[model samples]
Target chain A: MDFFQTIIALLESTIRLSVPLIFAALAGLYTERAGVFDIGLEGKMLGAAFAAGAVAAVTGSVFIGLLAAILISVLLSLVHGYASITQRGSQIVSGVAINFIVFGSTVILGEAWFRQGGRTPALSGDARFQTWDLPFADAVKDVPFIGPIYANLLSGHFLLTYLAFALVPISWWVLYRTRFGLRLRAVGENPGAVDTAGISVIWLRYRAVICCGILCGFAGAYLSLAMNAGFVKGMTAGKGYIALAALIFAKWRPVNIMLACLLFGFLDALAIRLQGNPLPLIGQVPVQLMQALPYILTVILLAGFIGKAIPPKAGGIPYVKER
Target chain B: MSNPYAKLPNWAEYGLIPLVNLVVAFLVAGLVVLLVGENPLNAAYHMVNGAFGRGEYIGFTLYYATTFIFTGLSVAVAFHAGLFNIGSEGQAYIGGIGVALACLWLDRTMPWFVVFPLAIIGSAAFGAMWAFLPGWLQAKRGSHIVITTIMFNFIASSLMVYLLTRVMKPLGSMATQTRTFEAGGQLPKLDWLLSIFGLNIGNAPFNVSFLLALLAAFGVWVLIWRTRFGYELRTMGHSPSAARYAGISETRITIIVMMISGGLAGMMALNPIMGEQFRMQLDFVQGAGFVGIAVALMGRSHPAGIIPAAILFGMLYQGGAEIAFEMPAISRDMIVIIQGLVILFAGALENMFRPAISRAFASFGQRSAAVQTKGA
Candidate 1:
């Protein structure tokens, strides 16, 4: 019974932890699918987190903060688009620059505005995203097994968390079923073909990038407004890169991305749990091993030790119309 | 039929365009300063005074520049082979392990010079080894170096944290770092060298690493431009198919270039570890690996450009610290904004002004030609 409760608690933590990864990975999915590889997902998410936290603190409204987050992330995404798509620059360089820019600008602006050493004031009341209680959560809490699974494991979460899980199927449907999705995929695989088919590849890529911006905004909002009380300097840490790794581990597939994120999230939750705990055979488990597992697995996957994770054919290459 | 914009002269290509981009980047940074409600000119004054006003300030700037030069060359060397070695951060981190091991083991027994050479070899070998898998995978298994290197960075960080906490930390010590090194591990300060100019680098961490960095820059210049292998590397970078047709082994070149890059990155540990801290501590690399990318990009991957670009960045680092001290509103992160702008303008948007400048130069040349012909 204790083991069962522990497992449920770990799973719940995993769900909460995986929310940001899902949003960022899905963001990368959209952008990469449109042939623009955005390593700046980290930067965009970070900028959005700062914007959401600062605006929420100022306006006392979570909705306005979300809007500001999306707006800021989208602006950053457009800068990336201008550099990578229109200017035909190196996508990686542009992405790297964006990361540095956002990383620096967030702290600079935060300090200037708040006088809080690169942090917004602690949010409270309506300024933060409150978790939602699913229907019958209270009634089902007393029941066993399935009751705990439904109520404890799945019930209490931010609205964005539920939306993140829902977006997985929505993303799959959009990518596999919609014409826009086909064009976006086509652009990633072969932009020339998409262009030859009378579609403006540039416009398609811009739209995809915008979608990435919107999703990254949600990820940022989830980080500051939900998972955390306020924006802390370098709060995103390497979650964006981990999301990228997860995206690759999942082979850019929507449903697979969620699973990969969950696996990583589980590792994160386990790492926290095993900090001082000693196992039977292994004795005291080093938390760093768990922290490093996702990256090591991703690298192994990339090296084809497990299986190959091939990226989009035209992912990093800037599209150039042959004269 | 003569299109002036089609063919650029050497001066304009290397000098004018970079200058314009740099100026634009600085302008954008200045705008940010203004937005923060500070006088841009006043901030600039403070930054310049902070970086270069005193001998110690110069020492600190050069010390920072020393690290940048090594990492910058690391990036440049790999870049010339068309390999983006993003794993330098990881390589440098692991290289710290090498330096730590060498200093810990040999510092008590050997002299400073003997330990220095061994430390260099240890750092280079370990850093190279850390990068070898990614390079090998790229060459042999078609794995992307960028993603693999980025992953390696996280792994390296985790490994370091574990090592520092569980293994390296002196028994019963509260800190996460290893014990300070003996005399053999310490790099002598360059005060004597600075004294020649009637200056003292008082309390600055500036040391022999600065000279080693300059030497490395020279070595890189010779390697990239004067060596037969460099010719082949450049061939592969410019046109891989042509390189293959020319009988250059793609796999060999890729792996070797990555190792060289990794080795260069690994050497960056010498400055901070042996020269400054004299002990292995966590987070010592401190994003210098990423700064190298910016330095290499701004420098056009040439040693001649990299040296000055590194100094510029060093000035930014030292001076920005001063700005943060003087101004209550502006923070040190302001330097990060400028660094980002520099990368954005000089790297990604490098050609933003090319068309207009080429057109102007082209028309100007045409008019001069017309005048010369008329004179003739």
Candidate 2:
């Protein structure tokens, strides 16, 4: 019973931790599906996190902060779109440049404005996203196994946490079922074909990148206003990259991305829980191993140690109408 | 509607375009400074004075440039073979282990000269091995080098932290770092090089690594421009299908290029571990590997160009510190902004101003031709 309780608690933390990864992975999905490879997800998240934290702290409104995050992320995404889509530049170089720009600008602006050595002031009530309990959560608290599962696992997440999970199915439906989804996927697989079919491939790519920006904004806001109290320096801390790994692990399917993120999050929660506690035979697990597991798994997946993880045919290649 | 890819005169291709990109990047950076409520010209003056105002400042700037030159060459080497090797950060981190191990084992017995050569081999070998798996996977298994190299970076970071905290920390020491090296592990300073000019290095950590970096740059220039192997790599980079038709072994070239690149990256550890710190410490690489990307792009992957590009970045690093000290509103992070802008304009948006410049040059040449015909 005690072990069951500990497992339940770990699962709860896993859900909470997986929220941002889910958002970022979905963001990657939108861009990659439109033939744009975005390694700048990290930069966008960090920039949005700083924007959200700064705005929330100043205006004392979480709603306004989220808007600012989305605006800033979308602006960065447009820059990327201009470089890769319109200018026919190297997508990888543009993404890398965005990461460096955000990594520097966040700290520079934060320190100049707040004077807290590259950190925003702490957020408080109303300025933060408060977690909400599901219906009957309190009513079923004293009940048995199923009750705890519903109350703990499914409830008690902040609004964006629920939104992140909800996005998985919505994204799947949008990508797989909608007419726009078919065109987006088609554009990724063969931009030349899309262009030949009388569609503006560049415009389609720009739209996909914009969708990516909006989702990444939510992920960043979740990091600062929902999960953490404020924007600490580099608070994203490679979660963006881990999300990219998860996206590849899932083969860019929305539902599979959610599962991969949960698995990575579970590893993280287990690592934190097992810090000093030694197991019967395996003994204490090194936290660094868990920290490095997502990257290791991604490399293995990319190497085809398991199933092959082929990306979009046109991914990372700029579309140029050559005569 | 004119041909955008038409060849230009050497001056415009090599000098004028890069100058325009650099100027635009600086203008954007200056705008950021203005938005932050600081005088752009004042900041610029301070940055230049800070980087070159004193002999010590010059020493410090050259010291930073030394690290950039090696890593920049690392990126350029792989780039010539049509590979994007982002794993230099990881390679450099693991290379530190090799340098530390060599020093830890032989510093008490071997002299500095003997240990230095062995440490170079150790660092290069370790760095190469770290990059080997990703290269092998790319060559043999068809995995993407960019993703694999990026993953390797995170793995290297975690591995280094585990090794530093769990294994390498001295007994009963509080810090998560190895013990300082003995005299044999430290490099002799090149203060005499400056003293020849009637100036002093003045407490700067400038050492012999700067000369080593210059020598490496020269070596890269020779290898890339004068060798059959260089021809093959450039062929493959320009068009892989053509190289395969010409009977160049794709797998072999890929793996060898990565090893050379990683080896260059690994040598960067010698500067920090032996020349500056005299010890192995955490994050000693300090994003120099990433800076290598910007340097390589700005230099157009030429060693002769890389040397100057490296010095420019070094000036930014040294000057940024001074600006942060003198101006309360601007921080050292501003240098990173400028670096990012340079990479964006010079690398990603390289052709932003090229078409316009090309058109202007095309019209001028045509007008001159008309004048010549009329005069004739």
Candidate 3:
């Protein structure tokens, strides 16, 4: 019984970890689909995390915090969009500049304001998001393998975990089912074509990138509020970048992106778990080997030895209107 | 749209253009000092004195310049082949691992000569392997190199944290760092050479790595300008279609160039490994690769031009660290601001210099850059 419960706990933990990754990856997909490479996802997320944490801590309102996070990151997206879209600058440089600006700004501000050494004051428990159990979760507490897994592993995950899953299908619908989706795809492939077709390329890319920023804001908030309950300096670390790799591995597809996030989350969880659990027969591997799993897997996947993946053609090529 | 090149004196085209890039870079750096509320003149004076005025400071500046040389060469190599391999941070991580693992495993058995070369080769190989992925992806799968390189850096950092904390743990302490390397693995200093030249070489960590860095830069310059391989790379970067029509294999060139780029950047570990650190360390790259991007940009991605750029950046960085001592309000991160502004300006240089050279300006706005403005 204990063994079964452990598996359930493992799966739920995995889902919780995968949520922000899924959101960030899907967010990246929207921008890349519109030919705007969104490397500033990290900056936008970090900016939002600070914005939300500061607002929530001051006002004691999670909803207002979420709204503030979204709005601030949207502003960041505009800077990213403005520099890349209007100025005809290199997207990579612009993206990197944005990341540097946010990373430094957050640290500098956090130090200057609260003087807490680049960490925001922790949110009170009442101000935090509560993890609600799903309906019928307790009724199947005794059902064999699948029952324990579903009830214990899947039942009590954060609200965002389930939302992240739902986003996959919804994103699929938006990308493939809507008129704007078609225009985004057209922009990514060849903005010249979209321009000739009478849709404004700059406007479409702007919206696509803005949506990415908003989603990334929630993703950052999830990191602080949902997972860890507070923010620390470089807390997001480079997870934003890893999410981007997953975005590429999925080839900009929504459903595939969800799967990729879960896989990465699985590796992450296994790394954490190996410290206590180890393996059944092989005994304990070194912690280095366990933590190295994600990097090793990423290298193998990216080596193109497994298979091929193609990026959108117009990706990173800033659309200059005068031309 | 008029041809400014048609009217400019020949010196204006070649000498003034490159000189202006340098002047503009320093101006931006000065602006950062002004923003940080330091006297730009005093800071600039301090920076000059701290880097080259005194022997001790010059030595310290050289230590900083050594690492930049390797990374700057790395960026320049990739720029030549038109690949943006930002994975230098990760490659440095992997190479640090390689250097650490090799030194620990083989310290007892091998002689100094054999062990040192093996350590360098191993480091280079691991860094090359790190670069090989984005290279292959760009070659075979059409993946964006910039994005992939960024991903690798994160993965490398995570894995390094785990490794240092776990498998590569130093023998005695609890810090998340590897054990020190054997004395045989240490980099030998040429302070003896400094003394031979009767230069005040006291207390400078100057080592043989400087020579190695210069050689690598020269090698890269040769590779890009003096070889058939380099000829193809330049052609491909300027116009991939033209290179393809001329029978060049874009995929092969890209993979090779990226591997070389990563390998050269990986060599940066030698300075750390053979010098004071004397073993692998976490945060080893310390944004050297990222700074190399600015260095490469400031150098206009030209290999020969990178040496002075590297030295200048080295001076700025070393000086920035000292600013905290002289002024409490400012921090070393002022270097980052300077870097960002320079990169922003350099990348968009066409705006400032291009319009300045227009024929329409030949009438009144400006004349011959060297003589006409002087007479006016």
Candidate with the greatest lDDT versus the true structure: 1
| Clashes within 3 Å, all models in order | 0, 0, 1
Name the runs in model 3 displaced over 4 angstroms. A125-127, A133-163, A289-307, A320-323, B1-54, B97-122, B140-143, B154-183, B190-204, B325-345, B348-376
Model 1: docking quality category: medium
Residue B232 Cα positional deviation in candidate 2, in Å, after optimal superposition: 0.8
Candidate 3 positional error at B88, Å:
1.6
Clashing pairs in 3: B187-B274
> What TM-score is obtained by chain A of candidate 1?
0.99
| TM-scores, each model vs. reference | 0.98, 0.98, 0.85
Candidate numbers sorted by DockQ from highest down: 2, 1, 3
After aligning candidate 2 to the native by TM-score, how far in Å is the CA of A169 from where it should be?
A: 0.9
The list of candidate 2 runs beyond 4 A from truth reads B1-4
Comparing candidate 1 with candidate 2, which one achieves the higher lDDT?
1
lDDT of 1 by residue, B208-324 (tens): 988988999999999889999999999999889999999999999999989989999999999999999999999999999999999999999999999999999999999999999
Report per-candidate TM-score of chain A alone.
0.99, 0.98, 0.94
lDDT of 2 by residue, B105-193 (tens): 88888888888888889998999998899999999999889999999999999999899888998999878789999988999989999
lDDT of 3: 0.76
A135-238 per-residue lDDT for model 2 (tens digits): 99988877899888989888888999989988999999999999899999999999888999999998899999999999999999999999999999889999
- Candidate with top DockQ is 2
For A161-255, candidate 1 gives per-residue lDDT tens digits of 99999999999999999999999999999998998889999999999999999999999999999999889998999999999999999999999
